[model samples]
Target: MRIDTRVEINAPASLVREKLLAFSEHADWNPFFTSIELVGCDIRDSDSQVKPGDRLKVSMKDVRSGKVSTFTPTVLSCTAKKFEWRGSLIGQWFFSGIHTFEFLEKDDSQKCVLLHHETFSGIAIPLLRPLLKGTQTNFEAMNNALIEVCENGC
Candidate 1:
């Protein structure tokens, strides 16, 4: 199973990426990621940032359950145009997901489009995943928040 969502923001890709990589400020505009702490760095530091191969402890709340889940995920890739990461549930056979993001420069040159997508695969995906709710809403909410923040000079 897969759930993908994306949005376009009227801002430069550099600014967008800068905001996205700002782990310390995630909770300011992102609800999905309540908090993210780098493995060996102070999350509250003003200069803290995430890079490829870094490990992160993330706390995310399940909208419906209202319960926060914590996990340590490795940074699969990070670059000016794209970013990716993978996480698992229990083990690979049970449930796993890959989140990918693309920051494309629009034809206008001054605007950018963000393509955020996630793929889920595992033997238990069909059985353990939520059926009543989907991740699309959360993704859109985050996108809107990001757009507002970036456009407002965050």
Candidate 2:
């Protein structure tokens, strides 16, 4: 399943990119991602910003699990307005997936688009199809929150 939605922000592209690229500020903007606790990050050695091939140990928790889920994701892309990460589900037999966020320059500001794509093979297809609806809802909410933050100067 793939879901994509865009929101126009009043802020300039640089500010929007900064908020999206900074994992440390996720708690204030992202609705689904409660927090990104860095258990380990490859950037510990130098001043270089995170890039493709960089790995991060992220701890995330939500209402569904009510418990933190830990996993390691390899950064796939970290350009000026694009960020993507790929990871597998830990402590489970679920399929591996990719999550991406793209911020495109609009007229005077930016258009932030969130993409959630999940690929499942075998018997899981039937079970996962129905779940995509809820997943889409959450993604929309997250986009709205991001827009609000950008518009309100958060």
Candidate 3:
């Protein structure tokens, strides 16, 4: 199953990417992933730049239920255009999710579109399908908050 959400931000892709990659500032604008921490990395003095293979311990809050869940995901990619990570429960066959954030420039304009999505697969997916609708709504809220942060110079 996949949950996708997008939002157009009135800011340059560079600015959008910058704020999105700024894990340290997530608490200021992000309502979903309320906390993010780089695991076992000594670069915590400043806003650490996430790179492929980096491990992240993140706390995500469900917008509707207000339930918080923590997970350690391995970063798959972190570039100017995209950021992706994979998190799993037990093993991939049991439960896994690939979360991604893509930044698309709008025809050479300052504006950009942010695509936030998560693809879930595993034997548990069928059982978890009922909660996906709320997850999508949470993604939308996060995208809107990203727009506000990126456009307002976060």
Candidate 4:
């Protein structure tokens, strides 16, 4: 199963990408992902940049229930145009999700489109399907918040 959401922001792709990767600043704008901390890295070091193999402790809030769940996901890729991570519950065979953020620049324009998605797999998907119903809306809320931050000079 997958949950994908997209939003167009009136900001340069570079700016959007920068803000997206700025994990330290996520709490200021991201509603779904309330907090993201680089694991094994000092939180005080605001300059820390995430790279492949890095692990992150993320706190996510359910938009509908206001419930928060924390998980540690390993960074799969971090690049100028994309960021991806993989998180598993118990084991990969049990449940896992590959989350990605992709930035696409509009043709010859300063605006950009952001694609936020997560691909879920494993045996638990069928049982967990109902819980995922509100995920799309949560992602949309985060995307809109990103637009606010990027366009308002964050």
lDDT of 4 by residue, 76-154 (tens): 9988788899999999899999999998999665999899999999999999999889989899989989999999964
**Positional deviation of residue 86's Cα in model 3 after best superposition, in angstroms:** 0.3
* Model 2 residue 139 CA deviation in Å: 1.1
Candidate 3 on 2-80: residue-level lDDT in tens?
Answer: 8888888988888888887778888888999998888987675544377889899999999989999999999999888
RMSD of each: 2.6, 3.8, 1.6, 1.8
Order of all candidates by lDDT, from best down to worst? 4, 3, 1, 2
How many steric overlaps are in each model, in order? 0, 0, 0, 0
lDDT of 1 by residue, 56-130 (tens): 788876655667778887778887888787888888778888888789999665888999888888888768677
Ranking by TM-score: 3, 4, 1, 2
- State each model's CA lDDT, in order: 0.77, 0.62, 0.86, 0.88
Hey, what RMSD does candidate 4 come out at? 1.8
lDDT (10s digit) by residue, model 2, range 88-116: 64422564557777766766454444433
Q: Which candidate number has the best lDDT?
A: 4
State which candidate, 1 or 3, has the greater lDDT: 3
The segments of candidate 1 whose C-alpha lies over 4 angstroms from its true place after superposition are 41-49
- Sliding window of 10 residues with minimal summed lDDT for model 2: 112-121
TM-score preference between candidates 1 and 3, better one: 3
